[model samples]
Target chain A: MTTTQDRQSAGVEITPLTAPAQRTANTAFRGLSITAASLILVTLAAVATFLLVEAWPAITDASGELADKVSWIRPDEGQSLIEIAGYLIFGTVLISAIALLIATPLSIGIALFISHYAPRKLASGLGYLIDLLAAIPSVVYGLWGAIVLIPVLQPFYQWLADYLGWIPLFAPADDGTVSNTGRVALSAGIVLAIMVIPIITAVTREVFLQTPKLHEEAALAMGATRWEMVRMAVFPFGRSGIIGATMLGLGRALGETMAVYMILSVGLTYSFQILNAANHNTIASYIAGQFPEANSQGVSALIALGLALFVITLLVNMLARWIVSRRSEFSGAN
Target chain B: MSKRIDVNNLNVYYGGFLAVEDVSLSIEAKSVTAFIGPSGCGKSTFLRTLNRMHEVIPGARVEGEVLMDGVNLYDPQVDPVAVRRHVGMVFQRPNPFPTMSIEENVLAGVKLNSKRMSKSDSQDLVESSLRGANLWEEVKDRLDKPGSSLSGGQQQRLCIARAIAIKPDVLLMDEPCSALDPISTLAIEDLIQELKSEYTIVIVTHNMQQAARVSEKTAFFNIAGTGKPGKLIEMDDTTTIFSAPAEKATEDYISGRFG
Candidate 1:
């Protein structure tokens, strides 16, 4: 009789929480997640819009003190609009080209060492070491390049001046000081190259390791040597991945500011000799160096340059993503 | 086809553990020899030893000698790389190189070794190899497509063609049909039968029926005890092994009573 009463009581009992309450709690959590994500998206859009709005005055005004104060806004001496566009556009391209030339081959070697040559136990630890290099503060890289890399490179500069100076790219001044001017675009490029190496190497190593074992075995079975197997199977299989890695590294190199500014002593002028630091400035460093002190008109011009960087990086990243997606179709499963 | 592989007193070790022990077998020229056993029986391990491919796994080593055409494969003077060149392999899964076109994959070994040949000669070789594997017509119009873009059966066939391109004396297959569908398995089985006429074929399979169907000679392997080395129970002509195996263990395994 007592057990029966207990069972009846249990069946008829009410809970402290209802289904609606649980539903409300879950809905609130989901709504909060969406709000947080939306906030980040809206914030970025607002910043871009603000930059555009602030730069409008500089874009409209021309041939005055206000225009002179804004570096990107100021037309070249007796220059048309077309020439101004060319100079701005070419500055970004030039920096990217110089950085890629120094970075691509070195990164490939690093990737090969990490993926194929390193001992299995050692590879993971070494890969993490490379990743740690990537995480170093950009300012720290700038300081190191300015204080250490510049002075150490001076002798090489003087030797090049003595031997290969007739080649304009390698030419040195009469003093042979090898200061920021000597370090110029070439020095900035080297520094930027070092900065992007970790990124490219880490990515390429992963891609190379993903090559199918059967493909490699097939090559080896065909009387191919180890190096031959890599040439026939690994290299061809990893081509798209390598290209994508190079583009990502190139993007980072192109937009780098603090290190380039620290290594390159330059005004707004562009020139043929990359070693002539006094002549060349990239869009990023130009904006970074001048924007802090600029008035409304000056601020607007700087924002325009930033906008150009945004558009360029966006297009490059999209193209890289597309290429990777296409490669995935073949690389899936077996 | 002109040479034979003789594995004498062979034992395979992965690290310190003995995976296969005292496996002695002779594979003749232009014939199909199949190693049949249950899972984890080291049939594949014994097969890899014949081609010196067991070394590919870190810490795995083989004791005794594998004599290929009267040359000791493990001799201090012999190069394993040269051994691999002569004895081609096909994996359980089809693995065509992802970035290479169909034609390029067929020419990969020659191109990498920089073996100079006229364009017509290369073209002829590619066509013949592809036809040999029964894949020429299916892929003829799509030679420029990536090798990985093919279906599983087609990819496996492409791999077979790649193996044949080097003109290897022996072809080693490890569960080659395990990853394929029924139709694909039949296609590969037919190819194997045809392949045995030109190249010596050694296969490791879990399917006793496949061993009976495809192999001229059959080897039965079984683990001795728990955590112990696998041993060859019996080996003989395919019909004899199935009909009247000398060892009780071989009869038990073949009858599906025990493994």
Candidate 2:
């Protein structure tokens, strides 16, 4: 009912606007975004359903003893699924933990060096090199681990068993002779460490770089040395970020298949001796090794093991999220 | 513990670009001196050079002598860390370590120096430093709370407590009240009056009224034009500078003619 003059007096603009087209685009893009998001959930659901369906036979079967068919340790012929995955799960956790232990400090150090210590040019160059390392195919790492790293680390493993043999982890077996085959959990862990370093370093370097400049200046103004400034300002600010990065590395290490399979002399024992050759077999490697020739029961068993690995990784990532969220109240970025 | 600062022919540069030209001033011990100027006039840059904190920035350098208690702070043999320990700084915006507790924030400087203190001593220091910043009564019951939980004014006071905890001879505050509200600014102005009895204080302020209110001596900085280095135009008692500055530019700036 209002005239143009009335509208103008009401402080409305008279310009011709393309708002309808913008609205149409907004609605279309929103629909596309929602479809993209739903696709992820749908895919996850499909994978979970498929894994459950494929693994159903191993969960229960013809004679009620099929659950024992996927025995991880001493899987002769007839074992239940619940009892089957114990050794594989243990090996996966042990190797990943060892790898994380070795990688965490080194990755954090590299990240700090790249973020704080290096010159701008050198830092960017190093960052690019690390990104390149991450882009290398896992198969290449497998080949390198098998060919170069294993042969090179044999002497160091022997030295550990020689000098630090008093420690229970490094002690030789009852016969007092070490397994000299370079293929051991320790070697696999070291390889995994090398593989995971790039990812952890990249993530942590970004976190350290994002440290608020005011906080660093505060520490430096307080008479803190360079190292002390990093310890006080950089580390505290990056704690949750470091935890996240380590968890990412841990997830990759746990799910790694080819490199671990090729590097570790797969064994079925439930031993914790990392230095002993032919003493470990992670679920991913076990699945990759056996899936090619597996029958229906074997395939179902492997699927069941894979499902267990999926659950483990899920739990670990959830824990990392919980830790990060719990500490978010104190983190500066929050 | 307050010490006199004598800056002689100071020139500050960042990557070969002169930020501040030859300027000299003496700041008396146990008194408050304020630097007032427009933004980008290098007042804050010059303040940082007092504690050797200017060099912390990459490519930032200074050619000058900042003598405190007859010792050249810029001496090659002198460690910047030690120099900073003797002269503490509070930044414009409140920057308490977000992860630290209120009590921990107070003890941050001392802890950085790796000084071993007994539990009771640390507790005493925390209380005394907070008291010195005029924040003890407000924070006494919640010393274990995270420093970030405090209000803006309280956070600034906590930062002041942190700077004073190390028992530094001089305290440098860079626009310490620019980000604060009027009430918080008044609180800080009161605290500065109390602090001047114990520690030499150098404050850089953009508010002329604030400079007149809190400072005994005032230094006015000015720049010739864009891309030119800043220079000190006048230094005198606050009343003299506010009422009857000698330089035409100083009078023009103080009387709101031009920057």
Candidate 3:
């Protein structure tokens, strides 16, 4: 009878074992993955901490006075956080909301057309064209909006003021005249809509294309029309994905800097009149416009404004995630 | 509501490739007819053509006349959607819309046509359909639950309930039990026998025993080689097809000699 150690050595020689090399490689891969994941978390935490440190001066300077800190009704320049960014915050939300309202339906339609309605060759060509639009820089969009679209949309703005002035959103300015320049929140929103369409369409199209074949067939076999089939099968299946895509577009519109800065005639007034060119200013545009000329206190104030924007976007994304999770059970994507 | 089906020189094609060559057969009203064949034999394709469901696929077309009670379904004036309404289908794998509740799933076909029914009537219809599919006892208390919450076998019966709620003249099943467990398969087989009294049933099955057990008439399809279109080899009473087939291919296939 052979000893156990001698038998093991013989078995190892026969098997040609690479266990030692495999174990080393496996440990190294696990370590690398853990390091990469930790790096991301650490980087995010570092950024947040830096923002807080930069913004502390503004937050503390306005602690004693209610008027300078959080009051939207008054403007003061001496304190670091004077003139609460209420209008900037509201303008960002309103403009982005407008962009999403205009883009969501159109993006979903284009996505549906690409996935279902259009012929195969035409659909792929259209998809490539949409992706190309996404590849275009925001500055180009701004320049085009300022030069070409502003002038072209002047008459449409006049028509809205003339015919639909009873609606507060489309009403004329306080001076009883709509701005002929067309540099307004509506215009910026339209530009943002054009900017965000490709992203939403790409995402929604992917989700629509992923509708299971069996579910689609089930609808078809039930005598559903093409549109009805989309309602029953495609839309329900892609509901959460559509919501997620819309949220992504909303995020882009909220943080969009160059396009809004170049297009909108910036204003500091707290007003809800989107059609008024003299009453629009978003946080991103404010930052880009004021950063170059800002003193130390002003810089801290701007960082505070940026922090507010970061918080708002974080809240919006969290809300979107909650909605998606709530609907995941019915979505059947899993 | 059952109806006879008459096929005349049916040929199925996908894009430029022929999938099934010219074939013709008649199916009696209120009877069970099973198509038995090996894989890629186009039995499922032929079944889909009976209800105009094959046309849903891009570039999938059929050159044939599928007459249901003397009406040609392939006529240009006759809408495929209308054809599908009259001839419902059950797929191989159960696909109850996950977004819909069990009751809503049963009413899907009826609702797709935009037909208005009173709440009581709708509830009645749902109950009867589920009872018809032999699923009411298991699912009655949880009719509001998502259809996908059911087990695989129950989901298949729910699909059967959905199909029958439309009260179609004919029902097409594409290997409905192939994805089911042995016990579930037996349950569906029993349900198919009961369904034949109310609906003209056409099933495409790969299992020879299932074909013998559930079908009254049997049709066998065969292909000569790879890349060749499938053809109907023979069709006869199930007893005769399994006992003394007219074609050698059918006999060999039934006897497990060769596909």
Candidate 4:
């Protein structure tokens, strides 16, 4: 206030370059933007710190009753939190890997169909429907997976067990008794695959559409068929983009809880039998299913599981970022 | 493999609009012909029609016939893709596949079509094509580098190499040097001289001096007004067209008069 009055009394502004009034406005905006940007970093740090604090007791075995009635979650005496986390991660990685394997190719094919094959009007309508698919609530997907998808996949699982039992991953039971229900990891994986398709497809379609026209024309001028041109120009240019999109889908798949929790009959066995009803458990679905009935220590242990999941997803996203940035080095020159 | 092209009453259209109307000209084999005109005069469109490339545009089509070695290119039995395989093109801008290295970019036409060749054959073809484009010496040590890593001039030459690797009979250049600097333009002009010994060359250029220098024969195209179809005003030996043009529009365009 004093400074303003003093400057007014001087009867002149700093007329050299930047105006004093504009500088003040600039400073205020700079502060506002800085605070807005720092809020994300600060919130991230706070969440990480809180997770560490809460999970420390379970990790160090300070919290008694870590192994309560739910021995499946905490395991036997003195089993380190790392081992529990490893089991959860294994399950999480297994189901999402299956989902990714199923989703990525399907998404790429669908993206290509929309971008290159379909008529323009039909393509737009199809794209809109896919985007709408992406917007459907996860809880709704959970319900659909439980009531609709699981029952539909039961016959398929039995057929796999009947003919393809030699593949250890698809084996139903040693006694050859076919499970009546489809509440298995394989079913959960397919549900997750369906969930991530729209997300991966939408991203890859955008990237494919952004392919440089000059390159496409070059290929066509050289007598390439449409498929060949897409192979030469579209696929190569959109490689990193597809990988990044798949990673985003993977991130969502790994952290997805409601869909998996509803579809899966969870158990903590180390069996790789995906067709079996009670073999493995993704960390997220496990947490969701067990959190409500958990003791204080049990909840702490679950948070530790969440921390492990957080680290894995963070690594996935970072790997995606690195891949995208690496492509830009050569990408920008063109 | 060089072949003469005879275009008869060619009319190019984009949907309902005629772009270039009733252009009939003979392009000699193993010689360079230049098409020169102002912007939007359809010189580039007429050039693309020789190789059926104008049809690549949606709703853009051609009427009448373009004959190469007595085969009508616009015939119902003629496949456009097969036509393009024999008649390659270089655009106004340099476009090398960014994802491919120099060696892959050189072999892109063959490799993308899944053609199988032994190691030695591919190595020889890459060498010969790059040499033909006058780019082998500068890029020999870095065949593994991405094509996008090359300078603008070198990338254009790489594109030329890719086009010729398919062994097309007629090569069409649409303002190939417009995007290049003067020195690079000279380099390409010199290249067009050597390339014409084995391939029929047709170029569309906005620069009169470039057309005068590089072409054996020159064709001038003109439009009456905007949205009107362009017509070929005159075509003659490069020396005669520049010295004593027959058409008033040709003389006017050549002498800095109203075109």
DockQ of 2: 0.86
Q: Write candidate 1's Cα lDDT for B139-167 as tens digits.
A: 99998888888889998999889888878
Between candidates 1 and 2, which one is better according to TM-score?
A: 2
Alpha-carbon local distance difference test for all models: 0.80, 0.91, 0.90, 0.89
Each prediction's number of clashing residue pairs: 2, 10, 0, 0
Top-TM-score structure, candidate number: 2
Tell me how candidate 1 scores on lDDT. 0.80
Q: Write the per-residue lDDT of candidate 4 for residues A14-87, one digit (tens) a residue.
A: 46455445577889999999999999999999989888889887777744446553455444555656666777
Which window of 10 residues has the lowest lDDT sum in candidate 3 chain A?
A: A66-75
DockQ score, prediction 3: 0.80
Model number with the top DockQ:
2
Error of 1 at A38 (Å): 5.6
lDDT of 4 at B54: 79
Ranking by lDDT: 2, 3, 4, 1
CAPRI-style grade of the A/B interface in model 3? medium
lDDT of 4 by residue, B1-259 (tens): 9999999999899999999999999999999999998889999988888777777687899888999999999999998888889999999999999888899899998775577999999999999999999999999999988998988888899999999998999999999999999999999999999999999999999889999999999999999999899999989999999999998889999887864
Worst 10 residues of 1 chain A by lDDT: A79-88
User: Model 3 over residues A176-262: C-alpha lDDT tens digits?
Assistant: 678879999999999999999999999999999999989999999989999999999999999989999999999999999999999
lDDT of 1 by residue, A144-168 (tens): 9888887777667767767887887
Clashing pairs in 4: none
